[model samples]
Target: MWQFFHKLGSPKWFYGIATRFMPWLLASGLLLLVAGIVWGLAFAPKDYLQGNSYRIIFIHVPAAFLAQSIYIMMAFSAVVTLVWRMKLADVFVKAVAPVGLVFTFLSLFTGAVWGKPTWGTWWVWDARLTSMLILLFLYGGVIALDRAINDEKSAARAVAVLVLVGVVNIPIIKYSVDWWNTLHQPATFKLTEKPSMAVEMWVPLVLAILGLYLLFGWLACLRMKTEILIREQRTRWVRDLVLAGGK
Candidate 1:
């Protein structure tokens, strides 16, 4: 296990592995996403209460879940980079930041759209919503800090520290609906309790979540490959690869 972990820190190894996996990832991600969209948008029953507006949850919940999940992943990568000085870990941090931010923004946008019909207000200062907004800011901060720094290593360290510190917001975001009397509904899918949703309703939601996760993985790998190419442009193999591609 330790050997596997240490080996993963190597850029050449990770790059090779990532390249090998890219096709499968892309194919699977697209397949799942299409399936989810069809199931959610076409077959799923409309909400008895919110009617068609509730359909937005297919996109909204998955995005919201990914928003928080990717941040935690970024923070974990930060810890790995800081403790082990793994260049691949730094690459992961850089690769995931923009994706995380986009997902966070999607979540917020969908939430507001859903709010208009449900809450009769498009915006609110609710705890869950506010914390999620802050999460978006944190992702932006990481991306900006990384770009602003001149030295790559220095930038990685700085962003890593910021990510580690900002992680405290995650749990706050997770439990905010329960912690305070907020307009936001409590978690819909729970492991502890049987899902409150009917099978028709919940199946599509599950598929959407799985599809979003696969999409995130696919995008992350693409971004990481780009970063690797940029950083390794001067290397013999990279130069050879480019020259070969041009032939």
Candidate 2:
């Protein structure tokens, strides 16, 4: 187990692994996403209360879940980078920041769109919403800070600290609806209990969530491979890879 963990820090090893699985992840993710969206939008039972407007949840919920999940992944990478000083860990952080940012923005935008019909407003200062906005800023900060610093090692350390600090907001976002009288509703899905909605309503959501997670995995792997190439350009493997036309 320790040997496997140590191998994970090797850029060459990780690059090879990522290359092998990236295509599979992309294909599976897209397949699931399309199946889920089509099923939910075209066939699933419409909400008796919100009607078709609630269809946005198919997109919104998945994006929101992935946005938070990506940040939590980054937080773990931050720890790995800081403790083990693993180059690949920092590489993961840099590669995924923009992806996280995109998903976070998607969640917020879809929330606003969903909110207009539900809450009668496009935006609100609700706790969950506010913390999610803060999470977006945190992602931007990570990316900005990484680019701002001239030294790669220093930048990794700095970003790691910032990520650890920002992690406090995650719990706040998760429990905000329960802790406060917010307009945002409670989670539609929970691991501990059965889903509240019918099988037809939730089955597609499960597929969507799984699809989005796989898509994020594909994106992260793609970016990490590119980052590995850039960082390892002077190394023999990268040189050989380039000479072989990036095969």
Candidate 3:
């Protein structure tokens, strides 16, 4: 296990592995996403109360889940980079930021859309909503910090430290609904209890979440490969690979 983890520290090896994995990940992600959309939008039974408005969960829940998960992933990568000085970890951090930001924005937008019909308002200062907005800013801040520094290593270290510090907000975001009386609904999916939703409703939601995770994985690998190529352009292996491709 330790050896496998250490091996992933190598940018060249990671780039090669990611190249091989990209096609399968991309295909699987697209399949799952399309299936989820079809099931959620058309086949799933309407909510007894919310009616068609509940269909927004197909987008809203998955994006919200990814928004938080990506930050945790970023923080974990930061820890790895700080503790082990792994360069590939730095790439992962940079690769994931923009994706996380986009997902966070999607979550917020879908939440607002879902809100108008259910909550009777499009916006609110609720704890869950506010924390999610802050998460988007956090992602943006990390991306900006990465671009601000002249030295890549210095920038990576700086953003790693910031990410570690900002990780405190993750738990706050997770428990916000439980801690406060908020307009936002409590968690829909829980591991310990049987899902409150019917099979038709829950299945599509689960599929959507899995699809988004796979899609994020595909994008992160692609972005990391791009970062590797850019940073390793002067290397003999990269040079040879590029020249060979021209043949």
Candidate 4:
């Protein structure tokens, strides 16, 4: 297990592995997303309470899940970078941030849209809602901090520290609805308990969530590959790749 982890520390090895994995991830992710969306939109039964408006949850919940999952992943990577000084960990943190930001933004936007119909307002300061908003800002801040520093190693170190600190908000965002009185509803799915949703309703949601996670995996690979090429442009492997492409 430790050996496998150690192997992942090598940029060239990971880049080569990621190159092999990217096509499968991308192809399956796109197909699953298309199928999930079409199934949810066309076949899933309407919410008796929220009606068609609830359909937005198909997009919203998955985005929210990814928003939080990506943060935790970054925080873990930060720990790896800080303790082990792994360059690949920094690369993962940098590559994962923008995708997390987009998903966080999507979650907030979809929540607002979902809220307007349910709560008769576009915005609110309820605990869960406010915490999710803060999560978005945290993601944005990490990305900004990374780009703001001119020195790559310094920027990565700085971002890693910030990520470790900001990780506290992830659980806050997650449990806010449970811990406080809020307009936002409790989670539809849970790890320990049976899902509150019916089989038909949740099946597509499961697909959406899986598809989004795979999509993020695919995006992360693309971003990591781009970052690797940029950082390793003068390295032998990169030069060989370019030469191979030209042949």
RMSDs, each prediction?
A: 1.6, 0.7, 1.3, 1.3
lDDT score of residue 182 within candidate 4: 90
Q: Write the per-residue lDDT of candidate 2 for residues 179-232, one digit (tens) a residue.
A: 999999999979999998889989999999899999999999999999998899
Candidate 2 scores a C-alpha RMSD against the true structure in Å of 0.7
In model 3, what are the clashing residue pairs, if there are any?
A: none
Ranking of predictions according to TM-score: 2, 3, 4, 1
Q: What lDDT tens digits, residue by residue, belong to model 1 across residues 1-247?
A: 9999988987667777877887787788777777877888888988899899988988999999999999989988999999989888999999999999999999999999999999999989999999999999999999999999999999999999999999999999999998999999999988788998899988878887888898788788889889988898889877876787821
Writing each residue's lDDT as its tens digit, candidate 4 over 1-247 gives 9999999999888888988888888888888888888888999999899988988988999999999999999999999998999988999899999999999899989989988988899998999888888888888999899999999989988999999999989888888988999989999899799999878888888888888888899899889888888898999988998889921
- Candidate 3 stretches greater than 4 Å from native: none
Candidate 4 TM-score, C-alpha based:
0.97
Question: How good is model 2 by TM-score?
Answer: 0.99
Per-residue accuracy of model 3 over 128-186 as CA lDDT, tens digit each: 99998899899999999999998998999999999998888899888999999999988
Model 4 alpha-carbon drift over 4 Å, by segment: none
Q: Estimate each model's TM-score.
A: 0.96, 0.99, 0.97, 0.97
Q: Count clashing residue pairs in model 2.
A: 0
Model 1 lDDT at residue 157: 97
Candidate 2 vs 3: which has more lDDT? 2
Quality of model 3 by C-alpha lDDT: 0.91
TM-score of 1: 0.96
Q: Give the distance in Å from residue 39's predicted Cα in candidate 1 to where it truly belongs.
A: 1.4
